[model samples]
Target: MCTACLIENVKSHMLSRRSLFSGAAATAAMGVAAGALSARPVLAQAKGRVVDLTHAYDSDFPTFDGKPGILYEVDKNFDPDGYHLFKLTIFEHTGTHIDAPLHFAEGGTSVDALPVENLIAPLCIVDISARAAEDPNAVVEPADIEAWVSANGEIPAGACVAMNSGWTARIGNPAWRNLPDGTLAFPGFSKAATDLLAQTGAASIGVDTLSLDPGNSPDFAVHYSWLPSGRFGIEGLANLEQLPASGATIFIGAPKHRGGTGGPARILAMH
Candidate 1:
């Protein structure tokens, strides 16, 4: 099937399955109220191994520019409330997150406005790890994309391209954020590469680092080059090494915060 047709089918399947679940939940609730509840599984378990692409959020997670990380407090405990509930204080951009177009572009789509179709697409991993190991500030260039295309065929339209610089290995360590001289160093996309991906009709771009642009970038050229075209970004991704160069399907489940420029997301990849 064509990429567009496959994407549409996936969307339709997702929506229909969601509706099925919702209906099942409602029926179960009604059954309990009417004393007709039975012990039977209502939904079939999904097949395949699902890989988590998100980083776990906690006080230890790295933040930008010395900013404070997540804070959690028990709002209610089983002793008093018959349930455990916690209150979380976190920034919208904390942990593994998605940056809507509005994150960098003026009057762009907010997190709530981002289409679900855009969040589900073919995943393409462009590995530049060896070069990144030698130079911490290595940026993915247009040549890298060309090399990827040469080996993996064309990057499908509406695909999410993830740059695997092997940076996730530094997560939770001080090296993930700042350097000795206080200059952040990490691999990210160059303006030329961002332009090439945008031209290819990519739905989104992602990186294992904290930002889509290099940590030391004075001007966020990559963000400017892509976000203005209504594309989104995913940052602080984990387990890129587990995904194949192609064929995996990524689903980004970002919080729908009204007018939010960005928000935490639970990204998953199904191979």
Candidate 2:
């Protein structure tokens, strides 16, 4: 039997299922409860993975205000009475962010307009850490994905593919930010891979870097290839090493900034 069927049978016996029909029903029930199967027994038995693909939000964290970086501010509210209150002033593309189609493409869906079903999906983590270490401007190409499939089988549809470049481990380091000509350097996806993913109709693409294109890119072809196709992109992801290549669901808890182009997001991957 297939691995899934075997897993179901094991789960059935563990749950004390007495018949084949009950086994099928148990599998269906387990699928429905997958998102919330973090109780003590399940956690102990299953030990599924959890990857936190969110930046640490703080007052002094670097955020994209307009050009490059901005920090948040706080205030003590004087609403006719002294009280402690706070405020945040950051750009839509700040920190770990989700790029709604409208971010780069005209007449595209905004964050709110995205379908609810698209909010959560499986994950495909491509390890390009070594290549990115050698060349900071390394771009993940279509051949990379093909090779991954050749080794790891097909990348499932409706999955959130995260390119692990280990860039998040270098966020605000000045030495790494400066290039030879006094410019920032980072890695992202090539237009070829972006186009291939768009053709595959993935719900979204993510990267563990500041942007989905090389830092010095002028045209942003990756955006052009994917955004216009109604697929979104997430940038500045963290903790990609904690996830497996596939079979994990991601939940993006982004603020519903109405009429906003893009915004910071809290992403959690559960396997």
- In terms of TM-score, the best-performing candidate is 1
Among residues 3 or more apart in sequence or in different chains, the pairs in candidate 2 whose N, CA or C atoms overlap within 3 Å are none
Over 99-148, each residue of candidate 1 has an lDDT whose tens digit, in order, gives: 88998889999999998877777888999999998888889999999999
| Per-prediction TM-score to the true structure, in the order listed | 0.81, 0.76
lDDT of 2 by residue, 66-109 (tens): 25444545577577557766666667787788898888888888
Superposed Cα deviation of residue 242, candidate 2 (Å): 2.0
Clash pairs for candidate 1: none
Worst 10 residues of 1 by lDDT: 37-46
- Which candidate number would show the highest lDDT if scored against the true structure? 1
Candidate 1 TM-score over all chains jointly? 0.81
**Steric collisions counted per model:** 0, 0
Task: Summing lDDT over every window of 10 consecutive residues in candidate 2, give the lowest-scoring window.
Answer: 38-47
Candidate 2's displacement at residue 148, Å, is 1.4
